[model samples]
Target: MKKQQQLYKGSLNTIIMKLLENHGRMYGYEITQKVKEITEGEMNLTEGALYPALHKMESEGFLDVEMERVEGRVRKYYKLTESGVKETNNKLEELESFVRNMQQIMNLKLS
Candidate 1:
């Protein structure tokens, strides 16, 4: 029930990539729920946003999707491709650097 906002656009991909890195493979709903839980409800991703990113990543060869029949529904599970694993690491590093720069600019310390 959280509203979608512009700031969440690019970062969702990184979050998904990181989740896949840790969780191995997961379905769409599971990904959404996990993100919500991990962020303590601060980040809420809509299917509209999530599916496109998943599909885009798959099309780009960053993710591999496998369909499995579960209880009458086809659940599309996603995992990182080799490229995705590399990309995840790079993105995380980039995010870390960005955070450090922001901290410097703001003259803030994490203590």
Candidate 2:
């Protein structure tokens, strides 16, 4: 699985939050498409993982859900709550720090 590669598995929440942070709100499918678009299909987020994380965030009060009718079907959109906004910022910082550390650690030349 793409999630098992490198350190991406841990950053799913960060990735979702950041996308919601930028896009304001999105449904599960939209989030998956966006990730694929951004990563050029390198990363694939499975439905099992995405929905559970979304539900967990919803339960944690980090996300607020809005239901809308589109194409004769109800679509559930997830928006970041006030607490989610704060959490997103924190997660972003944490991810950035980790990336920088990894970069530095991997910068060594093989002699």
Candidate 3:
């Protein structure tokens, strides 16, 4: 499970995009909590990693941010932009292909 969790680290961006694609919009902390809940505590996203990824995606034009004032503080929520949706679809297809290839290789009969 630890090894598998490491593999999941590479898919962080894809995971975030997919979640945003489904949920419409989410704040940074909310996204982290959601991942933790879905993974049942196996995967925890640290601030150092998650924030940089979000910032990079935002700069790449894959995400749009909406800032809201809540209790005298501003919260930034992220949602998929048009390009993000397209990128998410492409990434999902690529991930499926990669998984299939891995499965085939693992199933090879070698004496």
Candidate 4:
């Protein structure tokens, strides 16, 4: 795997939650495309990876799913639940802390 892909694999859930938190709700493909767009195509989320994570989060009560008919097909949308919002904040905090530690260890300039 490329470096970016490898790095992103560890934080897919946080990324998805943050997106939902910002966007309200999104279908799977929309989430994938948004990630691609935001990352300038450096990151591509495959269905194999995305669906399982969504299902797991839904089961864990971090997300809720809605089915909507669009263009003669049913699309499943994912939205963050109340607990999800809290978890997203926690995950973002953890990620930020990790980054700060890494910066200090590497003697990198803080942002």
Candidate 5:
């Protein structure tokens, strides 16, 4: 059984971008599974959420998709464009700063 994760706001884009950066290219299901596995099943991404984000990123010119036949099915694999690499860097920096500010405001103490 997978543990339910608390809904953390506004980091999915960063997560997806970072995943692409490491993996080079991935299909949608693979991306979702990788995130869930890496988080030890904490984060389960829904197709509803993942597809829309992927489409938005595609529309934004941050991602390029290639279609390939896999097991008699056409799978769309997503890869980062040059702009995507730049965006990923920016998003990561933004997320890091946001987390830092949040820690400060919440007085998060790590032992």
Candidate 6:
């Protein structure tokens, strides 16, 4: 809905993985609400994109899943695999570097 949301698309996985890295496991709905709360609704992850990404990461062995029934509904929880933990660290470093580089470029243009 906002222009900044478009810029966030590329970092969705890093966001999700980092959250899981810190918070243990989480379900899809929980992940959505958490992101909204953290960013004050500036960033959102649609179910359409989220599930596919979760499945892809699972298939790639970056995430492991467990299903449980909560209030008569099944919920799938995702957590990082051993490889995923390592990847999260690498992703965080890359993301931080990108932010620093972007900040430098923006500061140059502003001056």
Q: Candidates' TM-scores? A: 0.89, 0.92, 0.92, 0.93, 0.88, 0.93
Provide the overall lDDT of each model, using Cα atoms, as 2-decimal numbers.
0.91, 0.92, 0.94, 0.95, 0.90, 0.91
lDDT of 1 by residue, 1-75 (tens): 234456667688999999999999999999999988987987888899999999999999999999999999998
Q: What is the lDDT of candidate 5?
A: 0.90
**Candidate 2 local lDDT, 1-111, one digit each (tens):** 543544676888999999999999999999999999999888888898899999999999999999999999999999999999999999999888988998998997889
Clashing residue pairs for model 2: none
Candidate 5 residue 51 Cα shift, in angstroms, is 0.2
The number of clashing residue pairs in each candidate reads: 0, 0, 0, 0, 0, 0
Question: Which scores greater on TM-score, model 1 or model 6?
Answer: 6
Candidate 4 residues 58-97, lDDT tens each?
9999999999999999999999999999999999999999
Better of 2 and 6 by TM-score: 6
TM-score between model 1 and native: 0.89
Q: Counting only residues 3 or more apart in sequence or on different chains, how many pairs clash (N, Cα, C under 3 Å) in candidate 2?
A: 0
lDDT score, candidate 4: 0.95
Q: Judging by lDDT, tell me the better candidate of 1 and 4.
A: 4
Candidate number achieving the greatest lDDT relative to the actual structure: 4
Clashes of 3: 0
Q: Mind giving the per-residue lDDT tens digits that candidate 3 earns over 13-103?
A: 9999999999999999999999999989988888888899999999999999999998999999999999999999999999999999999
Look at candidate 1 and tell me the lDDT of residue 30.
98
Q: What lDDT is reached at residue 27 by model 6?
A: 98
lDDT of 6 by residue, 1-111 (tens): 677877888888899899999899999999999999999987888999788888888898999999999999998999999999998899999999999999898889543
